[model samples]
Target: MTTLSDQDRARIAAAITEAEKSTSAEIICVVTRSSSDYWAAPFLWATLVALVWPWPLISITNLTASTIYLTQLVVYAVVALALSFPSSRRMSLTPSWIRRRRARLSAREHFFTQGLHRTVNRSGVLLFVSAAERYAEIMADDSVSVKIGESAWRPILDALRGALARNQLADGVVDAITACGAILAKELPPRENDRNELPDKVIVI
Candidate 1:
């Protein structure tokens, strides 16, 4: 994954707000790097617990050494089975002969934010970052991407990256994007009568 500095992410968020079709910020969903941590955290934490707790138990049992060995054997088998099986909470992005796996990697819908291309499908979202003449993509299977537009996103992302430089990702960046960009509540319906304006002039402010 491309590690974006906090300053860079904030700028993308700001640019997103600027690109909103409406002058008044109108958006209902905002997904960011923090969102991935939430989903991956459980698996990460569970691994920690499993590692720390098992050694003491195994060591203590070794002195007395009885059915405890058999018990450990059973526990290990179950863990191995669970890891091999398909589950929603698995925190996986691996390809498999399943609908979810195929859908995430090959999503058809696409959008651009802060010169980054975002593609979405039923399985997951793909973020393609454009830096001058080069490009990179970050893949997350647990996310959904909605392309607002490049103009609104650029400012928002820039501000977010600034927040990162100050070590304010959780505090400043998320709040700024969610509150100023209005990504939690439902936004106004698209106006059928609204006119199209050129992208360059839309975010001049």
Candidate 2:
């Protein structure tokens, strides 16, 4: 769930109006599925070993365990470095979408996500990020042109579109920007796997 301020939502409505006329601005909102998995497969095993090995220092075997601990620490450090530099997901917030989303989701749920979505008042640009769940989709306004797959984006869009048609400018802003594009899906069919595949309801966002 998102929680953006009302002022930001107003700004987004302004931005969306600006976007409709500007063709150069390619607004891309990517909702990546299973996207933010930072825990490497080996992370848990290494951490467990490190925690257990430090207590029994008297045994000669504990000396070997210390070596294991150092190795584990190094590996974890390396992975952390990689994530901080290269693997971190770009988290952007459509302030209006946040406010709109908050109507549907809780604040604690969106805690770790880094918010970067800022409407540049008619300035054409792009915004992309990976979200939760296991699917993604692209929309051209209220109409979803490309159903990439099911993910957090789908549900979010559904809510946004609902808000739009009803003339709810706040939540409608998200729908205003999200349009169809090259969708990356992994085996999950957009319709069959979708959790919120309601008919296109522009007023629901």
Candidate 3:
């Protein structure tokens, strides 16, 4: 799993504080090791191998049915163990589309789960990253999108994607938060007596 050090977390938190100074939109950053466990990949591989292993033995040898069944169980166990050793390999076995879909779902889940929708002006933004899946998304509430349009987020997404490709998550998130703040500040600006409706911190899960 990938993680940021204490200094990295502090840096991100400070960036959020600085960005929110000019905009009413509440910005939140979230980083996670993966979107899902993807247990199906290993299980599928083991099942396929075990199913085929007994067929060949049945055709060539006179092994008893019970013995062949036991061997099949052993084969499944061995293959599962082999695939389980390194988590990276296990993730690779999963189809790319599945991983991306799961990551997208998780990002949406976090947007609501973190109370981004509960803000007073409906001006919350979430920057989400799933390191293992190499996925990132920027979600904004209806108020911001209605004023500035979702296309405004394209540049931020591109910057973040490049950073992730180079394995620089902390820098990417900081830059993204700054960019979001600028856009929000221009369109929404801070209301008179606007108070923070959400905590300014980096959330890891």
Candidate 4:
């Protein structure tokens, strides 16, 4: 997984500051290592490989039943152990729907955990990215959603995904935050008493 350097964090913070200048809506950015551990995938794959271990021996040599069972066990152990590493564990073999679902769920959880839903005007927006899954989600509170339709976020999300594909995560986030801020500025102009309810720092989880 790509960890954010201090410079990346600083850039995101500055972007948030610039974006929030004209908007009452608060923007919260969060990046997580992964959306889900996907432990079952590695185990399932390992088991499948183990199940086939006896096939070749059965076709060629007359190996004892116990020997075949032992070989299968060894195969399972080796495969499972090999996949235990974090990077190997989160392989792309997982279904896309599963990854997307988990990311969306995570985004919703952060929406509350980060206090985006608690803003006075309900105009908070969350820009959530899960690095392991290469997923990005934009969630808006009721007040903001009521004014701006979901389609409006597509352009910003597309730009973020583009940047992510190039390994420019920090830039992508900054661009997305800036785009979100523009929408909020137009729809939920700044209030004289508006305060920074959420931290501007990019949260790493």
Candidate 5:
């Protein structure tokens, strides 16, 4: 697993600080282990396997009802425990689309939770990452989004995706912030009295 060190955190914070110099945009960066626990995945898979394991015993074995029931219980317990592991839950059991969707929702939630929406000019941008899902999103408040349009963010998101793939998170975030700063500078130049409405440090969860 790629881990974000303290050094990476500091670098990310510096990037955000530097990026905000020319633009009034308040950029908040967040990184999370995962968007969701996906507790249902293990149980759902275990249930399906356990349900079929007993049918084989019922058809060909001489086992009594109580014995078969106990066997099924053991199967369910073992399968569920195995799948409960973090790697197992993320890689094999959970669907890709579901993981992406959960990450998307989480990014949106953090956009508001981080107070990015409350900036005076609504010039707030959220850079969110879900490590387990390998997902990244650039969420801008209405003012920025309206001025730049959503498609303008595709290259930024692509850069983020590639960085996540290579486990170069700090570099990716720095690049993303710099790119976002350039756009914001052109379309939403810093106001004379503008002040940071969000934290410059990277939020890790």
Candidate 6:
């Protein structure tokens, strides 16, 4: 979990302002700490570690049944506690498909939560980044999607991922927003009466 500083927030807000200048589409940026807690993986691993404790006691040591059971209980408790640490819990042990599924679901939730679905022209675009999962999603409202194919978003996502990998999250977001704005500007130019429909500040979760 990286937290954006006030300077980073200001830059993103400026970028949003610049991006919306020529487009009716409202672009909302959201960066979440994670997509999922992924507690099951750590719990499963701890259980497996605990199950192996009885083997060594039965084969190499002359421990009594009660003692072995108590030792196993301790092992389970210790292992679970160790795995519960933030760094250990954040391991990418979840399957790729699961990560992708979770990220997509989270993005959809934010889409409606951020009012992208209710934009007057149906041209809201959401650039969602999940730091824990290393996933980025570009979701657009119906009007924008109808004009720009899904494949067109791939490059923008790739750029964002690259920036995140380099620990340049804010930069990645600004660039992606700028790229998306260009597309939206071309496809859905601002109307004479176009008004800012959403907050320009970046949302952190």
Pairs of residues clashing in candidate 3: none
RMSD of each: 13.7, 15.9, 1.6, 1.7, 1.4, 1.8
lDDT of 1 by residue, 33-66 (tens): 2112123334444454455555677766554445
Measured with C-alpha atoms, the lDDT of residue 133 in candidate 5 is 75
**Winning model by TM-score:** 5
Candidate 4's error at 116, in angstroms?
A: 1.2
Candidate 5 per-residue lDDT over residues 13-71, each given as its tens digit: 99899889988889999999889888889999999999999888999989999999999
Q: Residue 16 lDDT in model 2?
A: 42
The lDDT of model 2 is 0.35
Global fold similarity of model 2 (TM-score): 0.25
Off by over 4 Å in 4: 86-89
Ranking of candidates on TM-score, top first: 5, 3, 4, 6, 2, 1
TM-score for each of the candidates = 0.25, 0.25, 0.92, 0.92, 0.94, 0.91
On residues 110-195, what C-alpha lDDT tens digit does candidate 3 reach at each position? 99999999998899999899988878888889988788876888888888888888889888888888888898899988889999
Candidate 6 TM-score, C-alpha based: 0.91
Those runs of model 3 whose alpha carbons end farther than 4 Å from true positions after fitting are none
Model 4 RMSD in angstroms: 1.7
Worst ten in a row by lDDT for model 1: 196-205
For model 1, the stretches where C-alpha displacement exceeds 4 angstroms are 21-25, 32-205
Candidate 6 segments exceeding 4 Å error = none
Assess the local accuracy of residue 181 in candidate 1 as a C-alpha lDDT between 0 and 100: 36
Q: Distance from true position, residue 22, model 3, in Å? A: 1.7
Better-scoring candidate (lDDT), 1 or 5: 5
Count the clashes in each prediction: 33, 21, 0, 0, 0, 0
Candidates in order have lDDT scores of: 0.36, 0.35, 0.89, 0.88, 0.88, 0.89
